[model samples]
Target: MKIITYLFLISFFTLVSCQGNAQKKPKSEQFEIQKTDAEWKNQLTAQQYYVLIKEGTEKPFSSELNKIKNPGTFICAACKHPLFKTKRKFESGTGWPSFDKPIDGGVFYSADNKLGYKRNEVLCAKCGGHLGHVFNDGPPETTGKRYCLNGVAMNFIPTKK
Candidate 1:
């Protein structure tokens, strides 16, 4: 009984230690596109600045991009860098734009624990702008990843004929 108790304590501590070392947000200088707060504010709208620069979230269903159904690409609103293609989009009914995956290497992930729990935060690879969170609760038929994104963080460029 004593040996079993000791093993349980060891396992508990290991789990706690791992969880304590949460991933930190990348520094602004690490991104390809660097901008000061003033510049970002000048370029993006109030909502855009809130979501992309200040790591804020917009009201669900508030973004026009959430209803976009045309073929094209979604680019970072802050930098116009390609982030996700329309083909990867799915009607997640989450009120925000949802995608199975992002354009390869166009975005990066960081660990976020602001809610008293852990969540994988997504950001633009080019500008280090906050986009949203990704989760495993996606369509299993595809990548099985639900990249729940803030629609205000991106702009859709419809494909031209």
Candidate 2:
């Protein structure tokens, strides 16, 4: 019992240390708009940092943009890359802001399973900020895709026309 306990403690601390270092170190070349960890920390708000940098989800219906019905474009908060247009925006009733599709070359995809299930993770192509997940249960009459995004990860650019 003593040996098992000792081994468990050692492994736990080692794992924690490794994860801490990973969070601290920035993969500087991972994105086009590369920034030091300090720069990102300074630029993004606490909520934005959580969702964009740490790949966390904001609370459902917490964003006023979820109810926005204006004519505009949704852009990445981290890099200002235009993602979804007003034409693609829709109410998914999932609480988060949903879009039918992203603009051409505006975003990239990765496979994320941090929640024990495979999901298509969306990120800003310019800054590599985590946007949200993409699911297939969108309105079938259209493209049949739902880009469920974290509101803190994007900003709405209202159109002038």
Best by lDDT: 1
Clashing pairs in 2: none
- Please report the TM-score between candidate 1 and the true structure: 0.83
Residue range 1-161, candidate 2, lDDT tens digits = 99999999999788656544433334456678988768999999999999999888999999988988889999999889998998899999999999988999999887775654578999898898999999999989999999999999999999997
Q: Where in model 1 is the C-alpha error above 4 Å?
A: 1-26
Compute the lDDT of residue 73 as modeled in candidate 1: 97
Tens-digit lDDT string for candidate 1 (20-139): 535445465779888788999999999999999889999998888887889999999999989999989998988999999899889988888866588999999999999999999899
Local distance difference test values of all predictions, in order: 0.89, 0.88
Q: In order, what is each prediction's RMSD in angstroms?
A: 4.9, 4.3
